[model samples]
Target: MEQDLPPVLSLDIGGTKLAAGVVTGDGRIHGWQVTPTRREEGPRQVLARLFDLGRKAVADAGEPEVAAVGISCGGPLDTATGVLGCPPHLPGWIDVPVGALAAEAFGVPSALENDATAAALGEFRYGAGRGTRTMLYLTVSTGVGGGSVIGGRLHRGAAGNGGELGHVMVRPGGRRCTCGRHGCLEAYASGTAIAERAREALATGRPSSLAAVGNPTAEDVSRAVESGDGLAREIWDETTWALGTAITDLVNVFEPELVVLGGGVTRSGALLLDPVAVAVARDAMPPAARTARIVLAELGAGVCVVGAGAVAHDLLSGKTPGKTPHA
Candidate 1:
């Protein structure tokens, strides 16, 4: 039995940041909460604090009422059962029943999702991919992860982990990725990968203007690229090239109406988007290339919260997953 459910509480658990908010059905965040994750605290301590953050969001929303809770965390997670199974981002956390825990805390139903998958849902419901029957969302942050909506439904695939789009091979024998794969898209184009390339160039005595930061981030590399630094341009070009190659494969396979790119690396803006878009347009199959529009995610940093809220909304509204929920 359910009364009109209250506003949904959405939580995003990231390696660097913890974001929680009360989200309404209209794709707006009511009371947003954010803090550093302090990941070394381990899943137990961090999760406790994360839960506390959720409470604060609910209180701040002043709604007296959040009908359900939605959690978006980095995967390898069990979206169907709401269990987080040994997420690489949350080292040592094995099969934690996060959804059930949230349900207990809030006295309401809870849903858990992969952060990338949640981001895709957010895009589908409210962002660049809105109204599209098929779309893809890729987040190129500390690690690259992506989710797809095919035939108007989130394609969970046979492995429940959604498709690991980031694992697509680009260079075949290039950089090693977190997933222990060489030449995966994540190895070449993620924000972490960009910084790594910059550091490697510096280590090899390549002349560049990026020596000042001691430990430059991806943004630093972008700044250097814009400043006409040869080394930086090399690294940036590699990043964009890898993105272009991988997205081309994706556009060909999924034939999505839109491909939404988000995450830290996307801050490079058109430097990244233009090349990837151009490559996809030139390399993908004509039908898919013609139909797909590569674009940046409109929700920005708030996507996880909104996406999780969307998940909870669907659950509360009885929109359970099936062969194709959106269809």
Candidate 2:
């Protein structure tokens, strides 16, 4: 049945990179192409390049006639209107009618979705969350973000951005968050936050291997932790603490069957997952803790591409974005 669905063009817009591909219903991407976003060029020029990339992907995929187009990006967007709001990732890109523009370019219907939300769907249908009725996906990249699938359907909150899971408070009145809140999970756990914390520590002349590097990143901290650097270990512990604390609350509230961790920071693997798992197991309600399994995402960098393609498939089938297609 999946193979019966036509291919679709999938576009993923990120602050740093843009990706395009033709995706079949089986979750296979063909003729994938990626380029720097160079967002400073502004929306008009950037979108033109994105469209060109999509056309190139389609051609590289043997010029299959796609049924629809799907676009995924960081949100604060209007899914119904297919307009991007003031997404913090893409500064200066406000109220862009991306869906309409994509439809016009491809001569087909188009769907727009929050990147994390679409990633949740992609995992649910084809990756780590497969066979799950309820799942939570968290991406701990430049900033933190999340999406949920509940009862086998995507859970887009009333505002249509899904829940801002990153904003959950982990430490009262602590670090300021991008959302203008205090002590958000993102403020402590994001890759950006990790690097910032390390840099701030180094500025104080702390003795650590991180200080030897001209500029340190999250990966540097992770490596330092592996090499037994006390400063890096301290920062890493706090990062895991924030993530675990926030996830405990989520597990208690959502009672999901799986929590899939993805994004740049998660490449640290067990260093990140093991401690968070322990904290959640110890802190959350017994029933919720026992039911929830934290795991890494499988689709890797292609997640949003596959996810957007899934949205396009839903459009072609007349199914709601999060709902299961009728047999």
Candidate 3:
């Protein structure tokens, strides 16, 4: 395995599940496997399962050898040191050396990247942002994460957290965000935020179809909106507005040629995109607004895995940096 090599193993670690696969040069997944995180089992247990997932993926892919391992997970993680710091989403997972552990388990080198950054790379290499020198990617799921391709390269921030795009202010003082900040874009636009807003609306005894659906999730809200439920429509509208505002800010700062929006919330598709696009066009600085195209990511749920594979491929080829050897 070498850094110049083309294909590699990819793994995606989420608060809820773990996914792994062999990502080929063509960006296709071979022997993809996924399982719940079972956080109650603790970090060590979770990593054991996560490593098993890699073995399964490798066996399934039938590739006797893989050049490297690419791992994608949430932050605040130290990609340079391959240590996962205290990520708020994954409580109790403190200072875990995930990248080094994966390398040892698999007997190959590995590279670590924030899941969002990996997604950005995956999109840049194989998805909607392909061929673009400057691109932005956001995953609006349990939380909002941002990453960018600047100067045709993934912009690894000084701390190796990539970019904390979700922390950007959209509402200023509207809701409490997970980042201990008030009214961040994540507080208003993420799937969790959408469901929370809908639940709050229901708690107010608002007349809506959502009440009938117990424990309404973001998907429920989307359905309600489609069915003309005013409550659902209102929440959905606000979500899009927050996304628009935050993205507009990013556009003004990054001047990226393309903005790729992914994650569970993006399933709303044109409903979500059209408005955000309009806002950026209308509000972003003239030059940035002129060339920026806001679109959905093409990799879908398999993005993190493929992105990890790309990073692993890079590591094997020596294109990656900041990977410390495992003990």
Candidate 4:
């Protein structure tokens, strides 16, 4: 199908899954594909599978050819260099030149972006943050990740990882964070953290619905909360508290018009959004709280793909430096 904007191939790499799609200018995705990441296979093997998935998406998209390739993954990756550093989620994946590889494989230039940063752009351009001048986005999944759009521009931060909103300290000396901090928001609010807290509670002989499952996930905890499980509620409440505390700080600092939450954990819907919104409303600085509305992301799963495609579109349109090729 002919598109107003040239279609681009976009890929999202997560520790647990890899997704690819052809994204058009309207932020719509065609030929979406997803598969288990199986990180144990290591970077080289996993990337081979990811590239294969991209090819499948392209074929399914039925486009004559992709204009460019865009990649989204966890940081600390160097977007300028397209190198994947050691992300906690994908342990041992270090210094891999993902962009160059994609460029070579597809015979087109490629751009790499931090996954959360791309999602922020996606939300700002076409999702929940559309029509908003300033926005904050957080994806609370395997780990907490964040990005922001300030003054209608994507903020890449000084290091190019964008703002590490997830690293905002929520508790001084509480749970250990993957970044080695005592109590960052990710330590308390990530899906991994929620599951860990629930499992720990069950280990202490606490009576709860989660105890029935040998290994409960964040989704399991959310389900338990829906059924009025006390232990699950406790974990969910703490998760919301950490998120609210951190977001309150961000709202005070950025004063964004909207804060959009996405990722797998957000599948809990109002069970997660209502409390966080209430806490931010009740606790954030008055002016900032009044302007900021907490909302769920409109692009449920293909956000990063569309965001990366947007970046590719920008590169092609000369909005970004064309270090990469359009064809």
How do the residues 130-173 of candidate 3 rate in per-residue lDDT, one tens digit apiece? 88999999999988997998998888889788899998998777
lDDT of 2 by residue, 1-327 (tens): 877889999999999999999999899999999999999999999999999999999999996688889899999888887889988888989899888888888888888999998888898888899899999999999999989999988888999998988999999999999999999999999999999999999999989999889799999999999999999999999999999999999999999999999999999999999999999999999999999999999999999999999888888877643211112
**Order by lDDT, highest first:** 2, 4, 3, 1
Per-residue alpha-carbon lDDT of model 1 for 57-171, expressed as tens digits?
A: 9999987988788899988888777888998887778898888778877778888888898888888887888789989999998888989988777777777777888999998
Give the TM-score of each candidate.
0.94, 0.97, 0.96, 0.94
lDDT of 4 by residue, 219-238 (tens): 99999999999999999999
Clashing pairs in 4: none
lDDT of the structure predicted as candidate 2: 0.92
lDDT per model vs. reference = 0.86, 0.92, 0.87, 0.90
Ranking by TM-score: 2, 3, 4, 1
Q: Model 3 residue 220 lDDT?
A: 91
In model 3, where do residues sit more than 4 Å from their true spots? 1-4, 322-327
Model 3 residue 179 CA deviation in Å: 0.6
